[model samples]
Target: MTSTPSSTHFLTIKNTFISTKNHIHTSLNTPLHAPNSPIWTASEIAESVHGKLLKWGPPGTICTDTRALQPNTNQWFFAITGQHFDAHDFISPQLYGKGCVGVIGNRVCEGWDNGFVQVEGNGNVNTVDSLINMASYARNKRFNGVLVGVTGSVGKSTTKSMIALALESLGVNVFKSYGNWNNRVGVALSLIGMDRNVDIAVLEMGMSGKGEILELARMVRPEIRVVLNVGASHLENLGSLEEVAMAKSEIFREAKLGDICVFNADDPLVSTLPVPHGVRKVFFGRRMGCDVRLVAAETADGGLGVRVVLEKEKEMVKFVIPSPGLHLALDACAAAAVATLFGLSLAQVGKSFSKFVPVHMRSELQVARNGIKIVNDAYNANPLSTRAAIDLLQSIACDGNRVAILGDMLELGSIEIESHEKILSHCCDSNIDLVGLAGNRFLIAAKNMNLNRVKNIVHANDAKILAQKIVKRLKFNDVVLVKGSRAMQMEKVVDAIKAMSIHIPP
Candidate 1:
């Protein structure tokens, strides 16, 4: 009779053999599947995901998008299926012929050799479940670095990027969730991408309902948890602000003793939450008691100048955030607090702020050919972020007119109308020259605003029309702010304005 390997034996083999191959040397020119990089063997992957491997080949990089398949590289493809699309439909012999290491899915592609791993499913294949299982398995077997989890109604992406950059400045090999991939699948993929070579991994967790963050937390098990704030995001499904706080707090569910939790002290909803027992808590914001406090913020040298007080060091530091907006300055403070926990000094953290880059479409400034300045913040929005963008628009010095092209904030649930109308007050207070409103909710809000408060207010049914109206009215050196929810597609307004402007002489 053959004896099965014990769990201890498996772990020992994984640690001994994998550790020797885990040092990955990545550079600007290095391909993801560069030579000498470590990859999981067929048996390791099969055992991790509990699937049966039929064919074996050299270890390679894992991929989900077939369009990104690269020839001559050892690629393992997963056939992930979604509600409206199934990756299985795209599987072909041609893909397998592209020197693929193997394919993992419920069904095998036609004419493929033994290079396929079959995962059993109930009735039909649940590729998503298989992917998640594989990711969890990989994370368990390979990842031994510190993990940080970031979540909130807004600023999850920005905070995640800032924290990752700050850690990288300290010479730590850091990996972060790409773009705004903060959902469950995105989080899993991000964690799975981490190898033992990484010193730290920053994962952003996003959700549309309760329990989502908890699920992600269980997968990531981050040692450091940063909760930026809890606001009106996903209020439609969650029902109330308190419920939103409850959901955001779930990021701490899997945290244990000695773990660190960062909170936004300026946000009453976030500051009042009780931290898990035995978990160390750090706070950042404009509040007096915060571990990192934003003393003051102002526009300086075409960016944001922020004065911060690091309470733990009992010192004050001033730095220029390479991004616009006071909200971003606060985000820098949050990032500084996280870096400090990782043993970075206040001076080191302050120096790193200058390297911070704003995520695309999130308060990124662009100058048009006509010398008009555009603040593109149309990536995503909720009531809180939209208000912050409006405040940023008013704070900047404009040589000509100040215009705002607004769109509906989606997923506000029953409070959608109330939330849209609430923005009118911000418009009235901003002293903006013209406001172009889009979406049904914003149309209603525009009616509530006093015509005298805003110089001109125009409502459009869609982004294309709103862009047209704003472009016709834009003047030289006018600073236009474009912001809305993801579903609103507000970036169209910025594109439209850019297309209309004459290219300025370089």
Candidate 2:
């Protein structure tokens, strides 16, 4: 008979039970941030991950990017092994020379002998599990803050930022998810270093396929879960819109009886998801009877003036987001719903939103000295967001031509051609004067479209060449909307436009 290893571990850390029988657990019966698990020491971190501490260093922070690694600090590096490249390969002698607290991973790089501590585990361990376990550790340990998980097909980064900024403006100690850091590793990283003084931890959760959000949600178990919308953002990986909806619905996996779940009532897909019994539902959008409903929205004073009414509170909140678009106003509604839950009044929520700025490369409104307006939305794009950007470009009071430098909406899988064609067609239907195109999909779609009715159009293999074309025809005060999928690097066009002198188009 195989004998069970005799191990009984009860870590009473700060009057919080951390581990029992080699397992860590959080009690829903216990209050939020009950201190069931306090901050972990170097030894505790090693023990939890089943890593052997060949050497010990002082407690430190965690870093993933090698370029950001600083010298002589208590920073532990999580060398993530990605698909195409191994981060361990980049861990150089110079990195050790600069000095860090330690490294965590199965790989033993060249600097192993360089006197820094290493938490290396056995069994083909490449640090992802340990990192995830640390994510769990983040969930269990420290501080008093409501962990809010945000997920959707688009606008996740903006929505996550909006919530954080609004709460922070109101003097809440907020810990926001770093820009677009929503993957499994990114999510873990956001939570693992959660400061104890934080009142709200707003984390963005992203996934490309099935089981991704569920896996992440199971680990963090956020108390407030916000599902914005479902669209064709990742149709290539997941197959269809229904499948995409299913993938996003996984964000609610860990939601329990007392948790709060938020959704966009106007979204056809996100509004209909099943909620666990006893969990509170907070809906936001233009739809009637929504907890937070968009009462009226319009361009006001160069920004967005949005009036939102909360049915349950029987109050109206008016706010101004430092950006334009009904979509962004809807995002504000989502943020307002979240703020209301934290005991913030409707008026306070409104005031806090006034400080919200668009994320860089998302919808940054920039004006050149010559009055050339650039809507730098080059971060990432899908069909839903592209339509909004198009509408916004047409609605802007432009004294000059409207040029839309559109890139390929990637990850659409089979519908790549259809999606691209529809966007080009939408541009044609609009008053956009010049429709600049990039990527093979758009090139193909441009060929398929009937050009007799379409406006002036140009094509380029990539962003660099496309910028040349636009600059040649570019005019002062011409409003340009630069947008593309993440892989397209369309910011190059925006940068090129800003750097190069725009020709006085003869």
Candidate 3:
């Protein structure tokens, strides 16, 4: 049976991973982050992203869109084409004068010697693979840093930040992913653009369908891989929970014999995946047998205070998560597991946890212009995460009504109706005083279900209309929660409330 490595002592501060093969040796005075010393020559990058050097020039920054191209900046261009749009159309001989060092693509449009790197693969997959390869090359050859990959249906960005904070608290220089930059393009850019002096790089891997995580895993080749949980997220593309679990498990594809795999053992789906023979398994959850277990979570100082148990050290760790909700606390617990693998004591990780803050527009408690508290969890949402946010809103002690402004949870596909119905039902049953809903799915759910059973509900066409409806009912000192899918743009409701008149419109 594979077990969690007791090698924590070996991964402390200043400890980093330095790949020996394909090692890049550059100027001592110039770091890889500095453009003066090219991290990769034209020939080197051609081989890196799996392209041919039809034309060659000095390397610069990487560009996928020409519109965002800065002239006279000496940047490289990637002319990616999709079914509706083609980025290659803007690439002309004049682009070089506009600061393009060269064009990286499969086509040789402006001629062979005009600084074009003939991309080897065809179609969108290959084009993206080429970028992934560039990230892979950078990870394998760049300055020393322990690479950490984070993935799950939710909590990726929050957990990624937590791990970085824990490491940084110990005086470890860390590189981390920002916002929701977990997709292919975002992940590639983050890895390639990292500061070369960091001790650790924490990245998030998000997938929309099958095989996406596997491809990202193949390229990232992280030393420590974190699988947070499997839920109803991306169900429209993946179809079922088992498929989501299977897809998430692909992150272990690059897990070599001794690599560390950290997972949420409390999840029925996540805890049951088949692990490769020799990889070390570290489990974090509220379950008793978990390697990193959550002992308790309670309300404290406008946030959540929790306790974690680290099995190896036989220590009980206590900390405060800067956000409310049990889900966010669990994410921080998972981060503690990852932090310990890097030789941080449970106490050390807990201290850092107390200082961690949620990303903007994500479970943040903000006081509006009229002193109303708004839970701005509008970053993105699914059935599971949306429900959690609802629970959070109900738990807070409110001076006035607890209002919930919710929009559609997108991409649920066939289960869209049922998902919205449950969320609406959850709101009605909770202590929430009023509810304002938007989106076709929620409307359908409200209409399909007996309105006699569901009360305190109002409907709107979209976020804008919902914002108007919510602001009209707004009261002084009321605690409101705004959340929905990314497409729903529920933040508009929060903004609308902030823009309200000094006194209630009544």
Best by TM-score: 1
* lDDT, candidate 1, 308-360, per-residue tens: 33444477877777667888877888888787666567777777777777788
Candidate 2, superposed: residue stretches over 4 Å from native: 1-41, 110-124, 302-312, 452-455, 502-506
Clashes of each: 3, 0, 1
Candidate 3: segments with Cα more than 4 A from true spot = 1-4, 7-40, 54-56, 66-72, 92-99, 106-115, 121-126, 302-312, 452-455, 504-506
lDDT of 3 by residue, 164-261 (tens): 88877555556776567788877887777665666677889999899999888877778788899998888899899898999999998668765788
Candidate 2 lDDT score relative to the true structure: 0.73
TM-score of each: 0.89, 0.87, 0.86
Error of 1 at 46 (Å): 1.7
What is each predicted model's overall lDDT from 0 to 1?
Answer: 0.76, 0.73, 0.76
Q: Is candidate 2 or candidate 3 better by TM-score?
A: 2
Candidate 1 is scored at a TM of: 0.89
Clashing pairs in 1: 55-114, 236-413, 369-504
Predicted candidate 2 versus true structure: per-residue lDDT over 1-506, tens digit per residue:
11121112101121121111232222211111222223345675676556767666667666766766667655666677766767777676566655455666665565465323344554455677778877786677654456788999888888888777666544545677667879998788767766665656788899989999998898778878999999887888889999998899888765786677888888888888877766667788877778777887777654333333433347886666667665788788888877666556778777777777778888888776555788899999999999999987876777789899999999999998999889988998896899899889998888887652344888898998989887787789788899999899999998888875654544
Instruction: Single out the weakest 10-residue window by summed lDDT for candidate 1.
Output: 1-10
Instruction: List pairs with backbone clashes in candidate 2.
Output: none
